[model samples]
Target: MEEMSTILSDLDEIKSALKKSVTKSDLTDIVKSIVKEMLEENKKEMETRVKEIEDVYMRKCGDLQDKIDGLGLEMESLRELNAKKDTAIRNLNATLDDAMRIANEARSRSNYNEQYSRKNNIKIFGLKESNGENVSSEVCKMLKSPAKVELKEEEILAAHRLPSKFTNAPRPVILKVKNTDIKSRVMKQRAQVKSAGIRISHDVTLLNTRLVQRLSNHENVSQVWYYNGSVFAKLVDSDARIKFDITDDVDLKIRKKLRHPST
Candidate 1:
């Protein structure tokens, strides 16, 4: 543009200089030639400018294509990396699940052992107590009378009142018998004793108590009772009497019964 402006200014000066001696026809021809040359130069300059812009645009397009190709490769690599991580995570979760199952099994075994130790025991509540009361004699006498379960005093392995849970009432008596038969007999005759303001239940371990609580929460279960070491349940919806072994996973067993009621 600057060169074209300079050429136009020089032509104007020459026109002024030649105007005094030049005829009209010669001046018109001279000015026409100069205008034609100026137009040719301007067209070449425009073409050159267009070619330069084309070159710059093509280089930028090639650079952008290279960047896009690099991005595609990076994305593919990231996808492969994520796939490997997903497999590793799945394997880790499986291992964790196996470890948890083994741990739970071991804990269940421990709880079973604890509960087994208290299998041949019965707990008697609503019994009066004094400081020097012979717990074994008192328990045997009560069983022989209202409980109607003939139990020898010698069959009583151990006897004691539990630690006082409340000051307003007497503590329940815990009686460990020599065999499970005695405890079963006591539970069998519990209804007769219950009528005389006496409550008889199995001497349960802490683990057994939790199991009983879970069983109690079952919708179909009307009453859950334990005798000796075994668990017995009566369903409200059906006469389907369910029995479970004295295992630590009694809650699991009870829940299984609820899920498959026919079983």
Candidate 2:
């Protein structure tokens, strides 16, 4: 009976140990707690790492955005500069084109036209006159015609050189009253007047009449007037005498040798 009681005790003890081993709730709870702790730590670490990564990414993105913004500003500046340059180039080309057109038009007009010197310049031309005294009337008739001249800047300076407009006008015209014989002598001299060097002293009135009639025939005579000692005649057919003034030009002097045949 003692041995059987001992064996029953041992079997009871084994059954209790087997029951404790089969119902492992406490161990499972401990393992589950440990896993939960590990999972929480891992989650925190992952969250921190994710936050750090996001910060880094944000910093890089900000820097990239700044770079992009700077590049955009630079591009905008370059575009503006290019636009200004193009505008300036276009304006310059337009100005050049306008200048060229004006130059061409002026050139075309210059071919057929001529420019004359200002007034106060004497022009020399032909005229009809009975004597040296009568050339003034012929010059007066010629002055009615239009004068053509070609003047330059240099010629204007040359006229200042001359002392007088006419060399023969140093003395005034001498007029005297005519006797009855003077009319008869003038009428007789009129027939052979052109060929012979015969000159008859006549009244101032007769001289003036003959001068007026002869000068009216010529077209080129510009002006005729009595100034100093002689009559002056101006011509308009050519650019013979109209020129610029100069300081050292010919002095006004009376020259009797330059007399032409009376017309």
Candidate 3:
């Protein structure tokens, strides 16, 4: 009987131990399932966060691209405006050049016409003057004696004393003849009156007078004179005659003629 009791006790002990082992295994399986569930939840949250970051990055890149496109368009517009301004400036310069050319042509024509009107007039220097004197009669008598040219008072269109800058000297005389032929005859006899301290010249424009004075002062010019309303210059030691006008740059012309005689 004792042996039967001992065997029953051992069996009970074995059954209790098997029940504890089974409980321990069930607890381990439950812990593993809970850990797996937590891992899956964390993975899902991380995926959501990654997706949000990608969306924000794409939006920022799109905004940057739009700004770059806008700047490119603005730059192109500025380039077009600059091109138009450059063209406008060039056109304005061309118009100004044309205006200057037209003005120069008009001035030249006016000077030519003024010189032509005084064709039959003569200027006499070193003529005696009085407070109240008959200038026409004196001119006629002087021409007859010294110049040896006969002139009637009726042939003289006008004779008068011109204003002189020299206060102490006698004023010059301006004589206008009826015809160019009579003027030519008097001019031919001008050398004969040089002994009487008298001088005669054509009535030239003020511009021609200044030009003649300048040419007379030039070192290369030997003689300067006016004939038939035109100015002429003789080069020193050279028989070449140079004809100048009011529009001529005498210095430049002389330099060019000296450099190239053929010109």
Question: How accurate locally, in lDDT, is each candidate?
Answer: 0.82, 0.44, 0.88
- Name the candidate that leads on TM-score: 1
Candidate 1 lDDT (Cα, whole model)?
0.82
Q: List, residue by residue over 1-263, the lDDT tens digit for candidate 1.
A: 99999999999999988886688988799999999999999999999999999999999999999999999999999999999999999999999999888887776678667778988878888988888999998887887788677888899889998988699998999889988776777788989999888898877777667667777897757898765455678877767777654344555765777689887
What lDDT score goes with residue 75 in model 3? 88
Off by over 4 Å in 1: 1-40, 227-234, 242-263
* Top candidate, metric lDDT: 3
Clashing pairs in 1: none
Residue-level lDDT of model 3, residues 1-263, one tens digit each, is 99999999999999999887788679889999999899899899999999899999889989988998998898899889889988998898898888877776776677668878888899999888888999999888888888788989999999999988999988999999998998898899889877788998889888788989999999999999887878999888777889997767888999888887776
Residue-wise C-alpha lDDT for candidate 2, range 10-40, written one tens digit per residue: 9999999988876678779989999999999
Return the candidate ranking by lDDT, descending.
3, 1, 2
